[model samples]
Target: MTVADLVVDCLEAEGVEYVFGLPGEELEDLLFALEDSSVTFVPTRHEQGAAFMANVHGRLTGEAGVCLATLGPGATNLITGVADAQLDKAPLVAITGQGGRERLHKESHQRLDVVHAFEPLVKWNAQLSDPAATTETVRKAFKVAEHEKPGATHVEVPEDVAGEAVDGEPLADHGPVARPAPDDEALASAVETLEGAERPLVLAGNGAVRTNAASALRSFVDATGMPVVATYMGKGAISDRDERSLMTLDSGPESAAGGAVERADCVLAIGYDIAEHDPSGWNPGGEKTVVHVDAEPAEVYADYTPEVELLADPTAALDRLADSIDSQWDAWCVDAHETVYEHATRTPDPGDTVSVSNTLPILREAMADSDVLVSDVGSHKLAIAREFPTYEPGRCVISNGLASMGIAVPGGLAADLALEDDVVVATGDGGFLMNAAELETATRLGCSFTVVVYRDGEYGVVAEHQEQHRGESVGVRFDNPDLVAFAESFGVDATRAESLDEFGDAVDATESDELSLIEVVLSDPPDRRA
Candidate 1:
């Protein structure tokens, strides 16, 4: 068998169902092999879109989502999404094709040092030079990408090498390696710290959701009677409807949840990664005692020094903590609870046209319990993170760490494929146009989803920031095309909603058989800063 055949065999052994990419000359051999394999190669309009799709797929499945690209420019285009997965902690395997090793030593056409280019972005990376190393390289890439603190990994195979015959065999599949339990001394110290505090709060981050610690997190809160708050990406780690949930922690210095942080003497940060939530904004004083629980040690930061760290699987650690702790705190943060309610019930101000405050709740209610909502990076992202109620951990997908725009459309498509759930893309006008061509991809795949475009005729987040910081907005506005017609060109039904009632009707009337777009004509000023 050829080396490319061996590579495909390894991917099959890893149980990879989809490979997203755009075709190129260097990838001919690999593409030919993929045609004969069971894994489907999803062709996208651009490598960026393909990378985004693969990135979100990994985020949802906890497996290494694979994306393929040719050498040089194609490889470079995959960098942003790959780096995003690296920083955001998503498991992804990025495969790129290179020129022959002999030509790579000289000034060869379409050849560059892909390994070093990817070194800064991946947890591990390798460029295959020998045909015999195919199976081992592929196996190592998948293993490292799916390891604890999961992130991106890269494997590059040259054109000549891919076409060469090889006798490499696929690695034997084995059951998952068992995770170690938390140390007894550390667990005891964490419990002691919690027991000593009168007002303790639980801070959930993206790691909590990635580790599937929702049930354990809920039990921990119930047993201790402590309130829980989530970071932007951490939303839905506990049901927002739960009384113990303080919705989500607002970003910036003065936040609605700041009162809870101020009143609490101790913080139990479970599966909390610093990337999703910046500690400086919330913990300016750096005085609160912290108990860090996750699959790995806490990231050392001046504002986030842990008094005790429980390094182990979050689910296992929480289960052990629940079994060891027997405590009750009757005193709750009444003010924080009130703040959460106020935010949850907030409505648009009188005479304000097209407001998220009035629109998101209707959309949330209309979606099924199993449906997924993906948020693009924009002002709406901040609002959704705070106002959207998630019943389950994977239900709400938001890009909080890298905060990349244009993720919603492709991300929703990926979520639909991975979860087999009806998906919704909530994006702003600026973000919509960033990768609007992906609409064709969605249509080609026949994946049904709803795209809600908040039409504000400007970069709303940047405009809001400029207005707040400089007392005036400039150079951030732009004219948009007739979004409805634009969407219609792609053979998708599109409509414009000018009022709350109209938007609600649009949401209610949406079907899952075809792609739909709802353009909300929003011209109102930004809501008060969080």
Candidate 2:
């Protein structure tokens, strides 16, 4: 058997049915093996798109997202996405081809130490050398990525190694892990905290969204009349319309969440990994006791010290917490819910041009009630995060922890595939240009995303820092092309908006198989993230 055959067998064993990548000469052997394999390889326009789609695939399906690229530049291009998955703790497997083993130390043009470049960020990085170790190496990479505290793993395969002949059969299938159930003491301690507290709020994050905990959390929140506040990554786990649940806002200004949590007596943090969202603005420490629980122990008590850490499955923990505590809300949670309701409708100042405060509410009105949204990273991303109030599942996508650039358009493509309709992607002008060329790919696939370009005219997030922290702009600013012209070049529809009514009309005109690009002109003091 060939090493390439074993590689395909390993992927099949892991239940990975999707592979995203751009083919190159170095991957010829593996691509040949994958030609008619069980998994369907998605040929993306760029390695950045492949990485982004891989992340989306893994996120929505709860499987490790897989992608491949050639050695050197091909592998280098996926760094933005790879680093994103690493920071967000996403389980993604990225493979890159390399020059032959004999040329390892020589400067064979495209040769570089790719493994070392990714080592600092990844949970583990390895270069597959021996044909004998192929199966075991593949198996271990998948397991480490899927196990507790999941993150990205990089595996490099030299051309010689992949093309070599191997005598043995492919490795056996790996099975589900036997995760330890919640211990009696831990469950008891969690219940005691919930039972004794007069006003408790359940804060759910990515962990709850990724598991069966959403329904379980809703059940507990409803039974106990506790208010629910989900993180950006945990959006939609709790229904937005539910009275006991706070609307989902994973990333944004921390003021509201910080204020709310400060007033609560007990905070039950389920799957609340601080990694997915920054804790810079929100302070969890206070007189209130926090009960932190997740499948990953390291993510526990990250933002604030947990009064109790229940190392158990999120769904099981919430289910047990529900059964352990009795229903009681003495108007405190109700008052806190009322406070959030008041802020949900608040908008940016009338004179505020650059603030996201005003832009968000305006965009929300333009959004189709069911339209899917994706965000690209920047200060603008943070602004949109706070501004848009998403109350449902599968409506939004972003690199919560990874914060990868060039993801907006690609993620929008994936969202279109998932929902089979036009999607709306909000990004800064700089990020849009990063992979705006992929608009052609989206057009070819007959999928579209309403490209809401926040034209701050530069990397405004970095620019914002330079102006605020350094008192001037340094490495930001660009004269971008006309959006209408760019989209027309791809045979896709486009429009530019400078006014409120124009923005709404632009969005209303978007339809299936028709790509729309709506570029919002920036203000000198754009408070886009208000």
Candidate 3:
């Protein structure tokens, strides 16, 4: 059997069902071997897109999301996505092609220090030195990627190794992961704090979202009678339409998600990863304490040490906590939430076209059931992250902790592939430009997702900040370019969001087969986020 065959065999044994990636000459043999296995290779336009799609697949499937990139450019292109998964603690296995050992330090076009480049962003990085070690490499990479504080893992396959023949017998199937359950002592202590607290709040994050812990989260929230405030990645964890939940306010010196962390007497951060939230967001107020239950123990004090930290299955922890705690806080929180919502709904500085105040309501209306929303990073993304309500699971996706732009288009494409339903991507112009080339990706794959460009013609966040504190804009303004033509290049449809009526029609038409772009010019004066 060839070394590439062993690699595929190891992956299949590990039960990896899918890999999202772009191919390069160096990894072609491995790809060919995968053709016979149940493992499916999904093609993506850019390595970054493949990485993001893999990240999402991991989050959704509770397994490692695998992505492959070739040497040099292929590996480098996936850095943004690898960094994102690391920050949010998602399990990602990124396989890349590397130059042969004989060619190391020699002239190679698609070669760089792949290991060093990815070291900062990944939990583990290795370029297979021993072909015999491929099986073990795959095994360890999977474990570490899914280990406490999960992140990306990289294994660089040298070109020569790919073409070599394997001497060892085919590797055995991988065994199951061994995760430590919550210690009885910690569970007892966590229960004690929960049962006695006057008012409790459940703060959820990407980890919670990935663990299928929403029901557990709901049970805990119901038991405590408290409100749920999600981080960006945790948006749909509690089905925002439910009054028991509160929106993740992204503005004000502190947000509602942050306030929820502070206002409660006890904070039960179920599967919450502090990295997904601003540092200030996790600081509880005087006398208030956090009981952090997560899959990773080391993450316990990485930001702020919780009074009780339990490394256990998120859903399992929640069930145990719910059984031990009971309160009437939810009813009271409902009232508090209504007031918060009213104050929050107020309009912000008018933009070139519509006021930021009007943006949320209109968007909320536009993206209803059957519409998938993709939010970019920065002010516009922050607004959507704060205001838009996600009623269903997986209906909305965002680069919460990473806060990268250009993620929406690729992410939207993946969502389109996975979910054939209507998809809408909300992006700041700068951010959209990151993966705008994916318009061809979406078109070629016949992936239909509507793209909405919240065009401020300026870096709205930095501009507003400069205007507020510095009285001048620097490194923020851009000579507005025609976005329609950009989409047209992909042979997709395009239009501008003029009056409210025209904008409504455009959004109504977003679901059509032709990928559509609705450019909403932020011509109005910029304002600070609430």
Candidate 4:
């Protein structure tokens, strides 16, 4: 068997269903091998889109989503999405084609050091230099990528090496790496702290969702009666529908969820990553006693020193805590929840111009609880983080880490491929156009998902920040082509929604088997500042 064939075999053994990327001459052998294997190769319009597709696929399915790219420009283009996966803690295995080892001693055309370039963006990375070690190398890549604190891993295959003859089988199937249980002392200390605190709260982050601790988290909340505040990436760890859920924590101290955090004497931070929302934002004084529980140890920060660290599987830690902890509730928790509820339920003022506040609710109403919403980074992202009510884990995908703007379109495509439920992408006009070429990719792949573009004719987030800090916005405004016509150019169904009613009708009218786009014109940014 060829080295390319062996790589494909390893992927199939790892249960990889799809590989996303733009084909190149360097990847010719690998692509042909994938065509013959059970794993389908998805050709994207851009390498970044391919990486994003793999990123979301990994986030949703806990498996290491695979992506391929040629060396030089192709590898460089994959950097942002791969870095997004790393920072967001999504499992992804990235393969890049490299020039032959013969030309490594001297400078050559399109021969950048891809392995070195990817070092900062991956948990582990290596070149496939020895064909004899192909099986072990591939297995190690998948293992490291899928391990606790999952992130991206890289395997670079030289063009000449990919065509080399190999005669080995993939490593024996070893299921998922088992996570360690919480220590007795740590567990006891956590229980003691929670039982003693008058105001204890749970702060769920992306790790909670990544570790599948949502069910255990709910049970713990049910037993403890403590309010839960989720980070943007942690939405639906405890359903927003739950009375104990204080919704997502916004940027400032005045946010309703932030208020809950401020009032919390003890915070049971389950699978919480400091990167999601910096501890200083919520625990400004570093006074709140933190009980950190996750598969990995807590990151060291001045504002986030854990009183007790339960370095174990989040699911197991939560399950144990649920059984040991006593009910702990405070009136302030209820007040915070009520405040969030009021804000979410508040009706928008009737007007001709559509706003994010009104637009989101209509889309939420039209979507099922199980349906997925991939939010692109922009002003709309902040609105979604604050106002959107997610009901299930992995149902609301946000790129808080790295927080790249172009993720939504390709991310929606990946979500649709990985999930049976409906997928929706919420992007601002700026983010929409970043990867808009992928609309054609989705169309060609027969992906049935909806893309909702919030048209404000500017980089709304940057403008809002500029306005907030400088009292005026500049360098953010731009004109756009007719978005409806732009989307329709890709042969996708498109419509323009001038009002909330029209947007709701458009959302309701989305077909199950067709890719569609809805352009919602917004005259003003939603008031999300706390």
Best by TM-score: 4
Pick out the ten consecutive residues of candidate 2 with the lowest summed lDDT: 248-257
Model 2, position 95: C-alpha lDDT score:
92
lDDT of each: 0.86, 0.74, 0.74, 0.88
**TM-score attained by model 4:** 0.97
Models 1 onward score TM values of 0.96, 0.88, 0.88, 0.97
Scanning candidate 1 in windows of ten residues, the lowest lDDT window is 250-259
Each model's Cα RMSD: 2.6, 3.6, 3.8, 2.5
Candidate 2 stretches with Cα past 4 Å from truth are: 12-17, 105-107, 167-175, 248-254, 278-280, 284-287, 298-303, 330-371, 418-422, 466-475, 524-530
Query: How do all the candidates rank in terms of TM-score, highest first?
Result: 4, 1, 2, 3
TM-score-wise, the better of 3 and 4 is 4
Residue 350, candidate 4: Cα error in Å is: 4.0
Give per-residue CA lDDT, model 1, range 78-124, as digits (tens): 99889888988899999999988879888878788999999999999
Better of 1 and 2 by lDDT: 1
Q: After superposition, how far is residue 134 of candidate 1 from its true place, in Å?
A: 0.8
